[model samples]
Every structure is written in structure tokens, then in C-alpha cells.
Target: MKRSDLSHTIRETLKRLPPPYDSHYGVVPPAPPEEGVSVAGAAKALDAAQAAFGKVDAIAAQMKDPYIVSRVLTRREAVSSSSIEGTQSTLDELLSVEETGDDGARDVSGKLRPSGGVVPWHQRIDFAARPTVGDTLKS
Candidate 1:
């Protein structure tokens, strides 16, 4: 069958599945393919499928009883917030190090020093010493 037909069929099948009694009950339908069944069309179909799955998940979530939902929501919120805070802290550390140039450099003792160099290590290759594979292998 056509890609659209297959996508629609999958969506219908998912919707037919029973939703959990305690959670949001909604299904985000997949978007129809804009073009024919090419790579791009396949990508679109995947996106649609993901959206539809998200909807179903939300619906199922809503179907849950209120107390359980509240507890779960609270836990999720806490975890999310904690995760965000952790990410923010990490980002802040990265940015601060970038700003101050303290991203773990090497000291005279071979210890990792704070980052504070003009250029990144990867970009600072020794162009002068660079030899082609043929040159290095030549007798």
C-alpha cells in the first residue's frame, strides 16, 4: 500500500488499543505526506507517527486516576526541574570556563590546569610537520 495508507492504518491501530484508565487520553494524528513516497516523505511519515504516538500517550496519561496523576506529575516535575538545574549548572560551568578560559589545560607538572589558551587544541595542529601518507611511507 501507499505510505500514507500505511501510516493511517498504523495510527488507527494504535488508537484502537485501550487507553489506561488513569491518564490523559488523546492521540496526535500523523501529518499526511506532502510529497510522494520518497526519503522526505518517509521522514514526514515518521514525524507523523511520533506525533500520533505522543497524543496517544497524553490521552493514556489523562486516563489515570487523579491522585496517582498528581503524584506522578509532581514526581515528573521534580525530576524535570532537577535535570534542568543540573544541565543549567553544567552549561554555566562550561560557559564560565569558556569565558575565563579555564577548561582544563595542562600545567608544567602535567596536571590539568584551567582552560586559558588562545586557540583550541584540535585547531592547533602542527601544519609544518604534517606529511602525506605517501611521503611518510616513502623509502
Candidate 2:
């Protein structure tokens, strides 16, 4: 093995600036999707979406009380969402906690949903009208 003499040059690295840096927060609107593009995949996806939405609309129409429907659906969704976030709270326990305050029965009673009472009616309505897949992707 032969040892070769090599002079290595050290490059000076730029140091990051100290705290109190300038930051600007701004919202930039996305450009609208162009019309009249005959993409095969997009058309298929749109059709599937319309079909799914039609089924949902039909189910919604059959329900006598939209409020109760929304409440039940929202509670189920909330339970799933909470469980994903590592908080395990069931629908019955959630309702009980909302009615009589947290009695320490469930570990996550206080954390799930609004402080008192079920999720607000307005919030549920907003959830129902939330943007669909085609709406966001197409527009």
C-alpha cells in the first residue's frame, strides 16, 4: 500500500441567521382547471364520483330527519377520527359525557367533541355540504 500526500481544502460553510427571522404568511388561490379536456381517466373518476354522490343523495332523501341522520353519522365519524388520534371514546359515552359533564368513566370524555352537548347542528350541516372529490380536483 502506497500512501499519497494529499492537501484537503476545508470549505467555509455559511452559518444560519440567529432567531427573529422575517416571515410572511400568505394564501395564494389555485388556478381553475381548464375545460374540454377529454382525459379518459378523469372521465371515469368523475362518473364513479357522480354515482357515489347520487347514492348518498338518495339515502339522504329517504331519511325523515336530516338532523338525526347527521348527528349519528357525525358521531360515528368523530369516534373513528378520535380513535385514529389515539383517543378511544364511544358514541354512548360521548353523549353521556356531553349531557352530565365528564364523570371520569371514559378516559377521553372531556377531549372529544365540544365541551358540552353534541356537535352543533350548524357544524353538522357544514360537514354535509363540504367539498366533494370532483369539486376540489376539477375546480
Candidate 3:
């Protein structure tokens, strides 16, 4: 529809959606591979991806400290999200907080301080005491 043909007001146009549109939108499924994408090319890309994953899997399996990978990834994700939330936090600060066990010592501690802050379940449980693993009620 051209702008010249639109005689209705902005409010009128918006109030009623045309065909294939409604107040609620449905989820769109993932698109199929493009028509031009050759089966050979797709197979080659899949092979490369599988090879890379195999190398990573082998390295991860051989690591003495597997949890370090998790910590590193968590810190990296926290650092990236800090900017979006208008917080100035560093990877070193996050690592230090976790190591020192300061108040609000979490991945996002720099963002959410301990003053009426949301606490993670990990912090609630006293791991040192080991009082019935599931019982977080123990003070």
C-alpha cells in the first residue's frame, strides 16, 4: 500500500490489523536451509563443526579442573551483561568477590548489592557444615 492511498488516520490504521495479523502474534519456526544451499556444502560445514566440537570435548575431558571452565564462562557472561545493565564490574572483581566470600558474593554481586538484594540458593546453604544437603533451612 502506497502512502498516497492511505486515507485513514494513524489511529484507525493501527486499531485493525489486516489479513495474517492479529492482536497476538504466533511464534515463528526456524527457517529451512536456503534453496541455493548445496547438500555437499552443508555436509562439509557440518563436518567442520563436528571436528571443532570433538577437539573441544577432548580438551575438556582431559582437564584436571573441569569446574574452572564453568567459572571462566560465568565470569565472561557476567562481564558482558554488566554493560547492558549500566554496571561497572570487572572479571577480577567478580573472581575476588567469590574467592573472598564477601557480602553478596555472586557472579552479579557488583550489580546486586546485599542491601535487600535477591540471594542465590547457593549462598543460603552452608556447605562447610554439610547438614543434610537438601535442607537449606539450617542456619
Candidate 4:
């Protein structure tokens, strides 16, 4: 019931799989607590999470407007998400594009803006519009 035991089983199973089909199948089950991790390691991870929560709570308590913090973080995440999709735009540029409602916003290089240049207002209205597995893991 150790990690090595699981790896060994997966390795042997893979050897029996044929080409094309081999890469298509996987046998990785979540390890039960009794099989996978040491209790001490779990305790340490829990303690770390609690400490992080306390620190974030303290910071939130001091913020005059927590909504501003949420807005900034959301904008940052938008920029990062766009970057992952090969769209290069900054927060200020994104805001300007949104304000102007223009697709012709010029980049610093004076070229036409990209598709993700401005997050569509509809997408912004609902943060729950999650990417599908294919969309997220696309090369």
C-alpha cells in the first residue's frame, strides 16, 4: 500500500498496453490515507494551511475596502489567463479597451490588438464561466 507499490503496478500495466492505445489509458487512483501519506506529513500540511489562512485573514481585516483587493486580484488573474492563451495585454490597456469598447486599440508597438485584448463584458459578469478541460490544457 506504499507509493512505490502503486507505481510498480502502473509500470507493469503500461508494459502490457499496445501502441496508440497505451498513451490513451491511465491507471492512477487516488491513494487512501492509510495507503499513501504519513500522518505527520498530513498534520504539517494542515498546520501550514491554518497559518496561511490566519495571515490572509489579518490582511483582510486591515483593508479599508476588501472589494478593491478582490478587483485587483481578479484583474491580475485575467491578465495571467489571457497570457496563457497567447494574448498580451496589461491591466491598464485592458481597462482602456473596456472603457472605449473598441477592438481597434493599438498595442505599444502600434499594431492591432488581439482577441483577448479586452475581456468581453459578458464573461466578466459571471466569473463561473470556467474553461473546459480541452480549453485549459490546450497546447
Superior by lDDT: candidate 2 or candidate 3? 2
lDDT scores of the candidates, listed in order: 0.47, 0.56, 0.55, 0.66
lDDT of 4 at 48: 100
Ranking 2 against 4 by TM-score, winner: 4
Error of 4 at 12 (Å): 4.5
lDDT (Cα, tens digit) per residue for candidate 2, span 90-112: 78875665578554444553343
* Candidate 3, number of clashes: 0
Query: Model 3: which ten-residue window has the lowest total lDDT?
Result: 115-124
lDDT over C-alpha atoms for residue 45 of model 3: 95
Q: Rank candidates by TM-score, best first.
A: 4, 3, 2, 1
Number of clashes found in candidate 1:
21
Model 1 per-residue lDDT tens digits across residues 70-115: 4333333433453444422222333344468655734446676443
| Model 2: per-residue Cα lDDT at residue 48 | 100
Model 4 steric clash total: 0
Question: Which one is best on TM-score?
Answer: 4
Clashing pairs in 4: none
TM-score of each: 0.20, 0.34, 0.41, 0.46
